[model samples]
Target: MKPIVAIVGRPNVGKSTLFNRLLGHRRAMVDDSPGVTRDRNYADISRFDKPFILIDTGGFEPVTEDRLLQQMREQSTMAMEEADVILFMMDARSGLTPADIEVAKMLRRVKKPVFYLVNKVDGDKLEHESAEFYTLGVDRFYTISAEHNRGVLDMVDDLMDTLPDVAEPSDREELTKIAVVGRPNVGKSSLVNRLLGYERVVANPTAGTTRDSVDTLFMCNKKPYLLIDTAGIRRKGKTVEKLEKYSVVDALRSIERADVVLVVLNAEDGVTEQDERIAGYVHEAGKACVFVINKWDALDKDNATFGLYVEKVRMEFKYLAYAPILFVSAKTGQRIGKIIASVDEVMEQYTRRVSTSEVNRIFTEATESHHAPLAHGRRVKFYFATQVGTRPPSFVIFTNQPESVHFSYERYLVNRFREAFGFNGTPLHLMFRGRDKKTLARQAHNPA
Candidate 1:
């Protein structure tokens, strides 16, 4: 497991900017607006092969009657629990406030390492002004600018040096990667926090609260899984910011790397064009998927409501026909437990392999039931079929006339195989190759 390093501070102190700076790119959204970052975003970071998990938390307000600030405080508390070292970022321009003093007192109670980071110190005068933060009772402090990448590397190096040696490798092979993807404000963070059984991430009523792909490692039923919470994927026209465009790219990359993807949908709004586009990307990537219809409790439904909604989903996302759908309310914990089980089931199909003899037998029955389409007045004939790969189960079918196989016939063959063997929740890659007499003879002899 990677050691978690959390960045925590009052709002507008440049925590998100510092997070993006540490990642060596603009991942988190940076704005002058306070409380722009309401959720605790996480990402993997490293310097010179020493890797660790980095988390960017919301502003720390220990005591507040305001509902939003209370929720933000809960998010920060959870981050403190998950962190191995906490970086307490302060604004040198604004000096220290009562909120900063309260945060320092809170950190002092916990028997953990906390580093005082005075941010926005762009020059000597600002660095000199940063001395006011020493009154918070932390002996060590670093003056830096997150936007300009000043003194950030040295702080990380020193933080890593202070951590106890972890013998495990940074990359663990026996782990399943699950990515939660959807449009903005579709309860992706809320779903993640519900599954985690804590306020691990800040969830607000605002849209686009999460701007980066945050990864968390956890276990369910003795099986380890990595959950990647990504930013909302918007259409090209709507992605105006340079940061937003990078976030879209990052979300797509997360889908590519995920073993199983939970395509979250807002049940209140039903399926939209943007949702379909996001699902199309998942299908094209050949990733196993689970259609998560969130906010189910808000829907006024009868017995026919589920069927109608499912029909709409199927009609829109026809390419993801094999994917399973589950209705869950992250707010009420309705059917949320089924998510991990569905992921496990899909992983079974994704990594499953079939014998060559079994594959050929199934193909033969399929062709007998539904004949292959003819092309150029010649009948299409399949000689044999074999599975070439596993993890999205790719198969190669050798035929006398590969070009004669029409799209409908190919679909028939895939459907037949899916019915004969359960390929639920995973995509099947079917390829056709034409074989001449010589090649067929060689293949018969080698049986590869």
Candidate 2:
């Protein structure tokens, strides 16, 4: 299970702002109003290569039968109950309050790791004043300006060091990881909620409700897979707020860690340049990708019209022609099951293993079908091949002279491997190794 970190603090203390900063997105609604956030938001947060679950709790307001504030308090308490680490946030600008002391007392009873944070410490004066938070008895403290992003990285770095060095699951061996990525309000979280068969992830009509990359683990065909529901990714120039900028960064980071990325496009809006950019990131990362045309039920499609849109999407993202596209309605649960099954199939194909003999046979057939280009008066001889790894299947090809192998020929080999093996919706890696003394020694031992 991923480690859980909870952010708890009073209203207007920048808990949501800190949440946005840590997650690199404005997932939580950040307003001047004290009780803007009503529910606990959870996201899969990563700093560097380390990944952990982060929960953003609503502002702690004294309960007196007001339905919404009461719910907020309950959510904050629930977050504390589920947290592996709790961040007790206070406002350096506002100074300590009775509510802050109350929240600290509440956190003290919980037997989990807790850190005291003073937010809005943008300058040296506020940083010094933040030292007063030591009275809360939480030994760990970080002074940060979430809005300006001051000292945020230092806090993250310290958190990374404090995190226990637990054994992380290998990307290949762990259940297949599929990320849902797209622009704001494109129903990415809605799709995740449908897949999990419940409202595990909060889905709202408001743009950027799902702030962090929230992950939910479930079994498909008894194979464990993680579904990473990330914040909306907007184009760089379109981002006006510091929070939105962070959200985009978080979305891209989610794609970087995923084995397969499901790029959700708004069916009503068709495809946009932002969609193309998002798809580009997946292809550039060398990850298997699947295009999800969400809210298809709302689209006025008549048979051939859907086909045209698909073709258009393919044309727009020609580099990702290898990626498969699926249509679904997260609100109505239309085609949701098929989406899960397709993800499983793509993951299986991604991690598919091939025998050395089969690889050699296919190599021979491919070479005969399209001979390797001649270079420098010597015929480029591709002798043998073997599977080196999976999770984006990589192979090493033994050649007479590795340096003689042109990049175009390598692409040809990779295309041939895809044609023969059907590693659909996955990237392929090819490496050239010169036939040297080590190769001869291995051959001599085998004597075949």
Which digits, one per residue and each the tens of the lDDT, describe model 1 over residues 131-164?
A: 8888877778999898888888898788868776
lDDT per model, in order? 0.87, 0.81
What pairs collide in candidate 1? none
Give stretches of model 2 more than 4 Å off. 1-5, 11-78, 84-88, 91-93, 96-173, 218-222, 374-378, 400-412, 433-448
For residue 49, what is the lDDT in candidate 2? 52
TM-score of each: 0.83, 0.71
Tell me the tens digit of each residue's lDDT in model 2 across 1-448. Answer: 6788899888788988888788887666677867655556667776555688888877787544766566568768878888888888889989978788888887778887787888889899988887777787776778888899987788777777767766665663466888999999999878987888866665767787665666666787768887888888887897886667767887788898798899999999999988889889888887888899999999776879877998899899987877888988998988888887788778887889898778888988988888778889889877678888887888888788789888888888888898999976788888888877677458534534
